[model samples]
Target: VAIMGRNKKTLDEAKSKLGNGAVAHQGDVTKFDDLDALYAKVDDKLGKIDVLVVNAGGLTAAPFDQVDEAIFDSMSDLNFKGAFFTIQKALPFLNDGASIILIASIAQSLGFPGMSVYGATKAAVRSLSRTLSAELADRGIRVNTISPGPVETPIYGRIGVPESQIDGMKDQFREKPLLKRFGEASEIGTVAVFLASSDSSFIVGEEIIVDGGIVNI
Candidate 1:
Protein backbone atom coordinates (compact mmCIF):
# COMPACT_ATOMS: atom_id res chain seq x y z
CA VAL A 1 0.00 0.00 0.00
CA ALA A 2 1.24 3.49 -0.88
CA ILE A 3 0.07 6.29 1.40
CA MET A 4 0.69 9.93 0.60
CA GLY A 5 0.25 12.96 2.84
CA ARG A 6 1.66 16.41 3.47
CA ASN A 7 3.00 15.74 6.94
CA LYS A 8 6.21 13.76 7.20
CA LYS A 9 5.58 12.68 10.78
CA THR A 10 2.10 11.40 10.01
CA LEU A 11 3.36 9.62 6.90
CA ASP A 12 6.16 8.00 8.83
CA GLU A 13 3.75 6.94 11.55
CA ALA A 14 1.44 5.40 9.02
CA LYS A 15 4.31 3.55 7.38
CA SER A 16 5.39 2.19 10.73
CA LYS A 17 1.87 1.04 11.56
CA LEU A 18 1.47 -0.81 8.25
CA GLY A 19 4.82 -2.57 8.62
CA ASN A 20 6.68 -3.50 5.44
CA GLY A 21 3.59 -3.64 3.29
CA ALA A 22 3.20 0.14 3.12
CA VAL A 23 5.22 2.92 1.55
CA ALA A 24 4.69 6.56 2.50
CA HIS A 25 5.09 9.46 0.10
CA GLN A 26 5.08 12.96 1.51
CA GLY A 27 3.37 15.41 -0.82
CA ASP A 28 0.56 17.94 -0.81
CA VAL A 29 -2.35 16.85 -3.01
CA THR A 30 -3.29 20.49 -3.71
CA LYS A 31 -0.19 21.02 -5.84
CA PHE A 32 0.09 19.54 -9.33
CA ASP A 33 3.86 19.50 -9.20
CA ASP A 34 3.78 17.62 -5.93
CA LEU A 35 1.34 15.08 -7.34
CA ASP A 36 3.49 14.58 -10.43
CA ALA A 37 6.59 14.00 -8.34
CA LEU A 38 4.77 11.65 -6.00
CA TYR A 39 3.36 9.57 -8.84
CA ALA A 40 6.70 9.46 -10.59
CA LYS A 41 8.16 8.01 -7.46
CA VAL A 42 5.27 5.59 -7.15
CA ASP A 43 5.74 4.50 -10.77
CA ASP A 44 9.40 3.81 -10.16
CA LYS A 45 8.65 1.79 -7.05
CA LEU A 46 5.41 -0.10 -7.82
CA GLY A 47 4.91 0.37 -11.57
CA LYS A 48 1.14 0.55 -11.00
CA ILE A 49 -1.35 0.94 -8.18
CA ASP A 50 -4.35 -1.33 -7.76
CA VAL A 51 -6.46 0.98 -5.60
CA LEU A 52 -6.54 4.76 -5.33
CA VAL A 53 -8.44 6.45 -2.49
CA VAL A 54 -8.72 10.23 -2.58
CA ASN A 55 -8.91 11.34 1.11
CA ALA A 56 -6.97 14.58 1.17
CA GLY A 57 -9.53 17.08 2.41
CA GLY A 58 -10.84 18.89 5.46
CA LEU A 59 -14.03 20.43 6.84
CA THR A 60 -14.38 24.15 6.21
CA ALA A 61 -17.77 25.72 6.63
CA ALA A 62 -19.34 29.14 7.05
CA PRO A 63 -22.67 30.77 6.34
CA PHE A 64 -23.04 31.72 2.67
CA ASP A 65 -23.03 35.41 3.54
CA GLN A 66 -19.90 35.17 5.66
CA VAL A 67 -17.86 32.91 3.36
CA ASP A 68 -14.92 34.74 1.80
CA GLU A 69 -13.00 34.00 -1.37
CA ALA A 70 -9.98 32.76 0.59
CA ILE A 71 -12.09 30.24 2.45
CA PHE A 72 -13.84 29.29 -0.78
CA ASP A 73 -10.61 28.69 -2.64
CA SER A 74 -9.03 26.84 0.28
CA MET A 75 -11.85 24.33 0.46
CA SER A 76 -12.34 24.08 -3.31
CA ASP A 77 -8.70 23.52 -4.06
CA LEU A 78 -8.26 20.80 -1.47
CA ASN A 79 -11.63 19.12 -1.70
CA PHE A 80 -12.41 19.24 -5.42
CA LYS A 81 -9.53 20.39 -7.62
CA GLY A 82 -6.96 18.41 -5.67
CA ALA A 83 -9.07 15.28 -5.80
CA PHE A 84 -9.64 15.64 -9.56
CA PHE A 85 -5.97 16.06 -10.31
CA THR A 86 -4.97 13.19 -8.07
CA ILE A 87 -7.02 10.77 -10.14
CA GLN A 88 -5.86 12.35 -13.39
CA LYS A 89 -2.19 12.02 -12.48
CA ALA A 90 -2.71 8.46 -11.31
CA LEU A 91 -4.22 7.38 -14.62
CA PRO A 92 -0.95 6.20 -16.14
CA PHE A 93 -0.12 4.32 -12.97
CA LEU A 94 -3.54 2.75 -12.41
CA ASN A 95 -3.74 -0.93 -13.22
CA ASP A 96 -6.34 -2.06 -15.73
CA GLY A 97 -8.68 -3.36 -13.01
CA ALA A 98 -7.87 -0.73 -10.43
CA SER A 99 -10.62 0.60 -8.16
CA ILE A 100 -10.82 4.33 -7.47
CA ILE A 101 -12.67 5.36 -4.33
CA LEU A 102 -13.53 9.00 -3.71
CA ILE A 103 -14.29 10.13 -0.17
CA ALA A 104 -17.42 12.25 0.06
CA SER A 105 -19.81 13.21 2.83
CA ILE A 106 -23.52 13.10 3.68
CA ALA A 107 -23.30 16.87 3.94
CA GLN A 108 -23.70 16.91 0.17
CA SER A 109 -27.43 16.39 0.63
CA LEU A 110 -28.09 17.37 4.26
CA GLY A 111 -28.53 21.11 3.56
CA PHE A 112 -26.93 21.82 6.91
CA PRO A 113 -26.37 25.39 7.99
CA GLY A 114 -23.01 26.94 7.07
CA MET A 115 -22.14 23.93 4.93
CA SER A 116 -23.14 25.18 1.49
CA VAL A 117 -19.63 25.50 0.09
CA TYR A 118 -18.37 22.34 1.71
CA GLY A 119 -21.44 20.46 0.57
CA ALA A 120 -21.02 21.70 -2.97
CA THR A 121 -17.49 20.30 -3.07
CA LYS A 122 -18.70 16.89 -1.98
CA ALA A 123 -21.61 16.97 -4.42
CA ALA A 124 -19.11 17.54 -7.19
CA VAL A 125 -17.18 14.44 -6.11
CA ARG A 126 -20.30 12.30 -6.30
CA SER A 127 -20.91 13.63 -9.80
CA LEU A 128 -17.31 13.01 -10.77
CA SER A 129 -17.62 9.37 -9.79
CA ARG A 130 -20.48 8.85 -12.24
CA THR A 131 -18.59 10.26 -15.23
CA LEU A 132 -15.29 8.72 -14.22
CA SER A 133 -16.82 5.26 -13.83
CA ALA A 134 -18.22 5.42 -17.33
CA GLU A 135 -14.96 6.73 -18.75
CA LEU A 136 -12.90 4.00 -17.10
CA ALA A 137 -15.33 1.12 -17.64
CA ASP A 138 -13.62 -0.04 -20.79
CA ARG A 139 -10.38 -0.38 -18.88
CA GLY A 140 -12.12 -2.36 -16.10
CA ILE A 141 -11.29 0.38 -13.64
CA ARG A 142 -14.22 0.88 -11.31
CA VAL A 143 -14.81 4.30 -9.77
CA ASN A 144 -17.01 4.90 -6.75
CA THR A 145 -17.72 7.30 -3.90
CA ILE A 146 -17.91 6.55 -0.19
CA SER A 147 -20.23 9.08 1.41
CA PRO A 148 -19.76 8.91 5.14
CA GLY A 149 -21.79 10.72 7.79
CA PRO A 150 -20.61 12.04 11.14
CA VAL A 151 -17.57 9.90 11.77
CA GLU A 152 -15.75 10.10 15.10
CA THR A 153 -12.96 12.37 14.01
CA PRO A 154 -11.44 15.39 15.74
CA ILE A 155 -12.58 17.78 13.04
CA TYR A 156 -15.09 19.82 15.00
CA GLY A 157 -12.37 21.00 17.31
CA ARG A 158 -10.18 21.98 14.40
CA ILE A 159 -12.77 24.01 12.55
CA GLY A 160 -12.53 27.70 13.37
CA VAL A 161 -15.80 27.92 15.20
CA PRO A 162 -17.06 28.41 18.70
CA GLU A 163 -17.06 25.47 21.06
CA SER A 164 -20.68 25.90 21.99
CA GLN A 165 -21.86 25.94 18.39
CA ILE A 166 -19.74 22.96 17.49
CA ASP A 167 -20.95 21.06 20.49
CA GLY A 168 -24.53 21.91 19.65
CA MET A 169 -24.07 20.72 16.10
CA LYS A 170 -22.57 17.49 17.35
CA ASP A 171 -25.47 16.98 19.68
CA GLN A 172 -27.94 17.47 16.85
CA PHE A 173 -25.95 15.12 14.63
CA ARG A 174 -25.85 12.48 17.32
CA GLU A 175 -29.60 12.67 17.92
CA LYS A 176 -30.50 12.51 14.23
CA PRO A 177 -28.55 9.41 13.20
CA LEU A 178 -30.53 6.23 13.72
CA LEU A 179 -27.48 4.50 15.07
CA LYS A 180 -27.41 7.01 17.95
CA ARG A 181 -23.64 7.28 17.59
CA PHE A 182 -20.98 8.43 15.19
CA GLY A 183 -19.27 5.91 12.91
CA GLU A 184 -15.85 4.55 13.65
CA ALA A 185 -12.97 5.00 11.24
CA SER A 186 -12.66 1.24 10.96
CA GLU A 187 -16.24 1.04 9.74
CA ILE A 188 -15.39 3.34 6.88
CA GLY A 189 -12.17 1.38 6.26
CA THR A 190 -14.08 -1.86 5.91
CA VAL A 191 -16.41 -0.32 3.31
CA ALA A 192 -13.40 0.98 1.41
CA VAL A 193 -11.69 -2.39 1.44
CA PHE A 194 -14.84 -4.06 0.20
CA LEU A 195 -15.12 -1.54 -2.62
CA ALA A 196 -11.49 -2.13 -3.55
CA SER A 197 -11.92 -5.89 -3.61
CA SER A 198 -13.63 -8.29 -6.01
CA ASP A 199 -16.66 -8.29 -3.71
CA SER A 200 -17.62 -5.01 -5.39
CA SER A 201 -16.80 -6.14 -8.93
CA PHE A 202 -20.34 -5.49 -10.11
CA ILE A 203 -20.74 -2.27 -8.13
CA VAL A 204 -19.52 0.56 -10.30
CA GLY A 205 -20.27 4.28 -10.21
CA GLU A 206 -22.36 3.85 -7.07
CA GLU A 207 -22.15 6.20 -4.10
CA ILE A 208 -22.29 3.99 -1.03
CA ILE A 209 -23.53 5.87 2.03
CA VAL A 210 -22.14 4.36 5.22
CA ASP A 211 -23.79 6.90 7.43
CA GLY A 212 -25.82 4.82 9.87
CA GLY A 213 -29.09 5.59 8.07
CA ILE A 214 -28.74 9.29 8.63
CA VAL A 215 -29.69 10.16 5.08
CA ASN A 216 -32.65 7.82 4.97
CA ILE A 217 -34.14 8.37 8.41
Candidate 2:
Protein backbone atom coordinates (compact mmCIF):
# COMPACT_ATOMS: atom_id res chain seq x y z
CA VAL A 1 0.00 0.00 0.00
CA ALA A 2 1.24 3.50 -0.81
CA ILE A 3 -0.06 6.87 0.38
CA MET A 4 0.88 10.42 -0.59
CA GLY A 5 0.15 13.62 1.26
CA ARG A 6 1.60 17.07 1.86
CA ASN A 7 2.57 16.50 5.47
CA LYS A 8 5.40 14.20 6.45
CA LYS A 9 4.20 13.78 10.02
CA THR A 10 0.67 12.90 8.99
CA LEU A 11 2.01 10.65 6.28
CA ASP A 12 4.24 8.85 8.71
CA GLU A 13 1.41 8.45 11.22
CA ALA A 14 -0.85 7.03 8.55
CA LYS A 15 1.92 4.77 7.38
CA SER A 16 2.28 3.39 10.88
CA LYS A 17 -1.42 2.69 11.14
CA LEU A 18 -1.60 1.23 7.63
CA GLY A 19 1.30 -1.11 8.54
CA ASN A 20 5.04 -1.15 7.94
CA GLY A 21 4.73 -2.20 4.31
CA ALA A 22 2.71 0.92 3.44
CA VAL A 23 4.90 3.51 1.70
CA ALA A 24 4.20 7.12 2.62
CA HIS A 25 5.31 9.87 0.26
CA GLN A 26 5.13 13.56 1.14
CA GLY A 27 3.88 15.53 -1.83
CA ASP A 28 0.96 17.57 -3.06
CA VAL A 29 -1.16 16.17 -5.85
CA THR A 30 -1.70 19.68 -7.23
CA LYS A 31 2.00 19.92 -8.08
CA PHE A 32 3.14 17.89 -11.05
CA ASP A 33 6.65 17.63 -9.67
CA ASP A 34 5.34 16.34 -6.36
CA LEU A 35 3.27 13.74 -8.15
CA ASP A 36 6.29 12.68 -10.16
CA ALA A 37 8.25 12.18 -6.99
CA LEU A 38 5.43 10.18 -5.46
CA TYR A 39 5.21 7.81 -8.41
CA ALA A 40 8.96 7.47 -8.53
CA LYS A 41 8.94 6.38 -4.90
CA VAL A 42 6.10 4.01 -5.60
CA ASP A 43 7.97 2.45 -8.49
CA ASP A 44 11.11 2.06 -6.44
CA LYS A 45 9.39 0.52 -3.43
CA LEU A 46 6.23 -1.19 -4.69
CA GLY A 47 7.02 -1.88 -8.32
CA LYS A 48 3.65 -1.61 -10.17
CA ILE A 49 0.55 -0.30 -8.48
CA ASP A 50 -2.62 -2.35 -8.62
CA VAL A 51 -4.88 0.25 -7.00
CA LEU A 52 -4.71 4.02 -7.16
CA VAL A 53 -7.08 6.06 -5.01
CA VAL A 54 -7.29 9.76 -5.81
CA ASN A 55 -8.50 11.04 -2.45
CA ALA A 56 -6.60 14.27 -1.94
CA GLY A 57 -9.23 17.03 -1.91
CA GLY A 58 -11.06 19.45 0.35
CA LEU A 59 -14.01 21.86 0.55
CA THR A 60 -14.30 25.50 1.55
CA ALA A 61 -17.83 26.61 2.18
CA ALA A 62 -18.68 29.95 0.58
CA PRO A 63 -21.91 31.08 -1.03
CA PHE A 64 -21.83 31.33 -4.80
CA ASP A 65 -21.99 35.10 -4.65
CA GLN A 66 -19.08 35.23 -2.22
CA VAL A 67 -16.83 32.76 -3.98
CA ASP A 68 -13.75 34.58 -5.22
CA GLU A 69 -11.36 33.58 -7.97
CA ALA A 70 -8.94 32.17 -5.44
CA ILE A 71 -11.61 29.93 -4.01
CA PHE A 72 -12.60 28.74 -7.45
CA ASP A 73 -9.05 28.00 -8.52
CA SER A 74 -8.12 26.36 -5.24
CA MET A 75 -11.06 24.02 -5.53
CA SER A 76 -10.39 23.27 -9.18
CA ASP A 77 -6.65 22.96 -8.83
CA LEU A 78 -6.79 20.38 -6.08
CA ASN A 79 -9.99 18.58 -6.98
CA PHE A 80 -10.21 18.55 -10.76
CA LYS A 81 -6.69 19.28 -11.93
CA GLY A 82 -5.10 17.26 -9.20
CA ALA A 83 -7.20 14.19 -9.87
CA PHE A 84 -6.73 14.49 -13.61
CA PHE A 85 -2.99 14.79 -13.59
CA THR A 86 -2.56 12.26 -10.83
CA ILE A 87 -4.17 9.64 -13.02
CA GLN A 88 -2.49 10.84 -16.19
CA LYS A 89 0.93 10.54 -14.61
CA ALA A 90 0.11 7.22 -13.03
CA LEU A 91 -0.47 5.62 -16.41
CA PRO A 92 3.11 4.43 -16.65
CA PHE A 93 3.20 3.02 -13.13
CA LEU A 94 -0.19 1.36 -13.19
CA ASN A 95 -0.26 -2.32 -14.03
CA ASP A 96 -2.70 -3.43 -16.68
CA GLY A 97 -6.11 -4.19 -15.10
CA ALA A 98 -5.36 -1.94 -12.11
CA SER A 99 -8.31 -0.20 -10.50
CA ILE A 100 -8.47 3.58 -10.10
CA ILE A 101 -10.87 4.84 -7.48
CA LEU A 102 -11.74 8.51 -7.29
CA ILE A 103 -13.23 9.99 -4.16
CA ALA A 104 -16.02 12.37 -5.09
CA SER A 105 -18.96 13.78 -3.19
CA ILE A 106 -22.75 13.42 -3.24
CA ALA A 107 -22.96 17.22 -3.41
CA GLN A 108 -22.26 16.90 -7.16
CA SER A 109 -25.90 16.00 -7.70
CA LEU A 110 -27.42 18.26 -5.07
CA GLY A 111 -28.11 21.97 -4.69
CA PHE A 112 -26.27 23.28 -1.69
CA PRO A 113 -25.95 27.03 -1.11
CA GLY A 114 -22.19 27.18 -0.39
CA MET A 115 -21.24 24.06 -2.32
CA SER A 116 -21.54 25.22 -5.90
CA VAL A 117 -17.83 25.20 -6.69
CA TYR A 118 -17.07 22.13 -4.66
CA GLY A 119 -19.94 20.28 -6.29
CA ALA A 120 -18.86 21.31 -9.74
CA THR A 121 -15.37 19.95 -9.22
CA LYS A 122 -16.76 16.68 -7.89
CA ALA A 123 -19.08 16.47 -10.87
CA ALA A 124 -16.04 16.84 -13.08
CA VAL A 125 -14.36 13.96 -11.29
CA ARG A 126 -17.42 11.77 -11.80
CA SER A 127 -17.40 12.62 -15.48
CA LEU A 128 -13.69 11.91 -15.75
CA SER A 129 -14.22 8.40 -14.47
CA ARG A 130 -16.59 7.55 -17.30
CA THR A 131 -14.36 8.88 -20.08
CA LEU A 132 -11.21 7.40 -18.63
CA SER A 133 -12.87 4.05 -18.11
CA ALA A 134 -13.36 3.81 -21.85
CA GLU A 135 -9.94 5.19 -22.62
CA LEU A 136 -8.23 2.64 -20.38
CA ALA A 137 -10.45 -0.33 -21.19
CA ASP A 138 -8.04 -1.67 -23.79
CA ARG A 139 -5.55 -2.29 -21.00
CA GLY A 140 -8.20 -4.06 -18.92
CA ILE A 141 -8.10 -1.22 -16.36
CA ARG A 142 -11.28 -0.14 -14.61
CA VAL A 143 -11.97 3.42 -13.53
CA ASN A 144 -14.65 4.13 -10.95
CA THR A 145 -15.72 6.74 -8.41
CA ILE A 146 -17.13 6.64 -4.90
CA SER A 147 -19.39 9.57 -4.06
CA PRO A 148 -19.65 9.63 -0.30
CA GLY A 149 -22.24 11.75 1.46
CA PRO A 150 -21.47 13.20 4.89
CA VAL A 151 -18.70 11.08 6.27
CA GLU A 152 -17.10 11.51 9.67
CA THR A 153 -13.97 13.46 8.94
CA PRO A 154 -12.33 16.85 9.47
CA ILE A 155 -14.13 18.38 6.48
CA TYR A 156 -16.54 20.36 8.61
CA GLY A 157 -13.80 22.17 10.52
CA ARG A 158 -11.89 22.97 7.37
CA ILE A 159 -15.02 24.26 5.67
CA GLY A 160 -15.33 27.11 8.18
CA VAL A 161 -17.51 25.47 10.76
CA PRO A 162 -16.21 26.47 14.17
CA GLU A 163 -14.97 23.76 16.47
CA SER A 164 -17.69 24.43 19.03
CA GLN A 165 -20.37 24.31 16.40
CA ILE A 166 -19.21 21.16 14.65
CA ASP A 167 -21.24 18.80 16.82
CA GLY A 168 -24.30 20.98 16.30
CA MET A 169 -23.69 21.04 12.56
CA LYS A 170 -23.43 17.29 12.52
CA ASP A 171 -26.71 17.05 14.38
CA GLN A 172 -28.41 19.06 11.67
CA PHE A 173 -26.80 17.02 8.92
CA ARG A 174 -27.91 13.81 10.56
CA GLU A 175 -31.41 14.47 9.33
CA LYS A 176 -30.28 14.64 5.72
CA PRO A 177 -29.48 10.96 5.44
CA LEU A 178 -32.00 8.18 5.77
CA LEU A 179 -29.63 6.45 8.16
CA LYS A 180 -30.09 9.34 10.57
CA ARG A 181 -26.36 9.81 10.93
CA PHE A 182 -23.16 10.56 9.13
CA GLY A 183 -21.15 7.74 7.58
CA GLU A 184 -18.00 6.35 9.14
CA ALA A 185 -14.73 6.76 7.28
CA SER A 186 -14.33 3.00 7.39
CA GLU A 187 -17.62 2.63 5.55
CA ILE A 188 -16.23 4.58 2.64
CA GLY A 189 -12.96 2.64 2.84
CA THR A 190 -14.86 -0.64 2.58
CA VAL A 191 -16.42 0.46 -0.67
CA ALA A 192 -13.06 1.57 -2.03
CA VAL A 193 -11.61 -1.79 -1.13
CA PHE A 194 -14.40 -3.56 -2.95
CA LEU A 195 -13.90 -1.42 -6.01
CA ALA A 196 -10.16 -2.01 -5.84
CA SER A 197 -10.51 -5.75 -5.38
CA SER A 198 -11.72 -8.37 -7.82
CA ASP A 199 -15.16 -8.44 -6.21
CA SER A 200 -16.08 -5.45 -8.34
CA SER A 201 -14.22 -6.60 -11.45
CA PHE A 202 -17.17 -5.92 -13.70
CA ILE A 203 -17.83 -2.44 -12.32
CA VAL A 204 -16.43 0.29 -14.57
CA GLY A 205 -17.06 3.98 -15.07
CA GLU A 206 -19.51 3.70 -12.18
CA GLU A 207 -20.24 6.12 -9.36
CA ILE A 208 -21.06 4.17 -6.23
CA ILE A 209 -22.84 6.41 -3.75
CA VAL A 210 -22.08 5.32 -0.21
CA ASP A 211 -24.36 7.98 1.19
CA GLY A 212 -26.71 6.12 3.51
CA GLY A 213 -29.57 6.82 1.08
CA ILE A 214 -29.09 10.57 1.24
CA VAL A 215 -29.12 11.05 -2.51
CA ASN A 216 -31.76 8.45 -3.27
CA ILE A 217 -34.03 8.98 -0.33
Give the winner by TM-score. Answer: 1
Candidate 2 lDDT score relative to the true structure: 0.92
Best by lDDT: 2
lDDT of 2 by residue, 108-217 (tens): 98877788999999999999999999999999999999999888886787896567766876786798778898899999999999999999999999999998888898
Kindly report which residue stretches of model 1 are placed more than 4 angstroms away from their true locations once superposed: none
RMSD of every prediction:
0.9, 1.3
Compute the lDDT of residue 90 as modeled in candidate 2: 98
How much is the lDDT of residue 107 in candidate 1? 88
What overall lDDT goes with each candidate model? 0.91, 0.92
Steric overlap count per candidate: 0, 0
Q: Least accurate stretch of 10 residues (summed lDDT) in model 1?
A: 152-161
